[model samples]
Target: MKNADNSRRAFVRFLAGSPLFLAAGIDGKSLHRLITGSTRDQGEAFDLIDQVSQDRQISSPGEALDIFDFEPVAKAKIPPAHWGYLITGTDDDGTIKANRDGYAKWSLRPRRLVDWSHLDTSATLLGHKYDTPIVICPLGSQKAFHSEGELAVARAAKAKNHLQVLSTVATTSIEDVIAARGAPVWWQLYHTSDWNQTRAMIKRAEAAGAPAVVFTVDLIGGSNRETMFREAMNDTRTCTNCHSGGQPRPGVSGRVDDRDNRRKPAFANPAPGAPIPEAGPPTWDYVKRIRDTTSMKVFVKGILTPEDAELAIQHGASGIFVSNHGGRADNSLRATVECLPDIVKQARGRLVIELDGGVRRGTDIFKALALGANAVGIGRPYIWGLGSFGQEGVEAVMMILRKELEIVMKQCGTTSVRGISPAYLASR
Candidate 1:
């Protein structure tokens, strides 16, 4: 086993250095030659497991040419369990595929013979100016991917002058993530049954200079996650799922914000070692409760149906955030993009409409904006970058997205971010 591991690691280095590997990756000719050359390697499953383990331990971040580059590296480098948790949607993965493939359902209407001299991707959301409309979704358990975790993401977003939303379940404490940012960060509140606990979190966020509150309404309880179950992100002894009404064993706890140490945050969300609260659903009363507690602009996330979007706005929501919880919230396979147009029409410009899930490329962002999403939220792409290359890797991913969005915007003959509309879209 030892000999095989060392040989495989060496092969990984060779592949990484080879120019052919840059475009095709390790599964190309070199890999076949190595495996076929050894009789022991023949008829035996080579999972590339050792290579993955080595990459996670190495000092260097893997080579990254684009956002997609990070995915394979992350899967290879991180523990199978951790990577599985990050990438897995719900059962059947219909929503996951939808998020990625749904872009093909519509085509871009590129205007020609127009002035393509210069372009700007600058976007303003909820009165904040971002270099681009790309916002990182509030993904939790960051330390599971990289040592720097959410801090790495915060630094990257600050470096790019982009918006970053911190999950309530973030491994890095809210104050710590906020402290790491040069620009302001938004907070994603997992509204718990205990409104008092929820209020405490909101108050802490406001004091720490969080400009907005993304009240995620999708995950009231645990969604069915067979992938996570199989990957060891959960098990009998370590299942901290809210639906089970049990606490996971003590491990990988990110400190909740308590800057003054006067009052600690009472988190009621499902995370390692935290009790997943029995928060059933958000009501007008709950919305009012949130409003009564904080002055930060509140955007209700997890909205798919038009009636729900309209009701949220009517109940004093500042914006409608459409998300499928990255396809992790339910068994439904419908991607958030499919839900955007109805949401946009029902909200009818009553509030800012932001989207999360399946935002993998620059053209994906273009499609979202053209369909009426004011801003697009990215989840897994940044994590893949962070897991593979740390902070610099994340920064690289953002740069790629910005450059790609700029190129596509120019192709469509649109220069400004808000200038994007249905005019730039055609039926598939």
Candidate 2:
């Protein structure tokens, strides 16, 4: 009998070598329908992929996996600067590399023949049950990619019965996004120089029935995203949400002096001479103000330290997301996963510990759960799907991951997410 890790490696290798998956004969629509339909039954992961491939007149799941080769497609479709902004890492990308490399340091210890037929991937976070243990990480400026923008993303999330975290710098208004999803969504907030504006945004979220408020704390200063600047030099397209205030001018430091000296200005076509609101720096008092203003659950994002995690709990944070801002923030920070064990230990279950960074496979989801994350957030991949096929593309991304997770659970001799624990992993 093949071990679980070997099977996964073989599957990945098969995907690498297979040509049939890329052939034009396979209709993406038909393949999508078949895979989604199989989710209802106690379907085996590979079985569904195989069925989809065959129905679509393809050779195998390996061929289908080729669709994820994002670099070439993304490069061709997006402008060079935009591509750089989308793909580049902060400060030489060392931490970005480590974010995924860290995962390799931990190996799975799979058990066999435990009668693991019924696998459940459903998870509940902050008192809400999600179809999958994945939440949509808040990524701003969707209009930069597609005209439908955030609305399209929201529609996709709603279609999959998944949760979405709307960014404070979203192109669409909070009310509009909530309306599009027709349900409560999570809102991601950043502290601004104006307390009134921050308070108002929280009130708006509450009024719109937002389930949680995720305060992003890592971006006290804007990241050194040179790609976006390069792109702006040629393109007129600006991040509507971020540009609504006004474009900042070049400061003495030669960097764009954004109204909020905290964030770096990356968008184009800023309203001329408009006062750039300062973000200054944030304090724990801001957190308390946020907590006092909203009845919704408060989650602090960008936490990678156990001490910060503990401090968040003390400041009335109901949850903490261990993220490196998708490697867009500090370049020297540790990978979010590397800090999870310690943060979880310090949190002591006082707050929900969610993680998001370099999660591209079903095993990645499994790894996070085993190590101690309440749930994981799916970021760039879903957006890549959106960029490729709109709502259908998003659906495909989720389906692929959910199916992979099911297979991982069964092979690891587990029937439910609850069955996952640190015991399932060994230090590499």
Provide the RMSD of all predictions against the true structure, rounded to 1 decimal.
8.9, 10.9
Q: Rate the local accuracy (lDDT) of all candidates.
A: 0.75, 0.71
Candidate 2 segments exceeding 4 Å error: 1-67, 230-280
Clashing pairs in 2: 21-63, 221-262, 222-263, 222-264, 259-276, 260-278, 260-279
lDDT for model 1 comes to: 0.75
Model 1 TM-score (2 dp): 0.78
TM-score of 2: 0.76
Which residue runs does candidate 1 get wrong by more than 4 Å? Answer: 1-63, 233-281
Minimal lDDT window, size 10, model 1: 253-262
Which lDDT tens digits does candidate 1 get at residues 1-428? 99998997786566546554444345545555656566435312144533433443434443544577677777666766666577667775668878777788889889987786767788898788889999988887787789889999999888998899998777777778877887679898876554555666788889888888988877665566655545554333343332132332222211232221112232533233444354556665677667767899888989989998887877778987899888887867787898889889887789899988888889999999999998998989899789888898788888888889988998899988888999899878
Give candidate 1's error at residue 37 in angstroms. 28
Best by lDDT: 1
Residue pairs with clashing backbones, model 1 = none
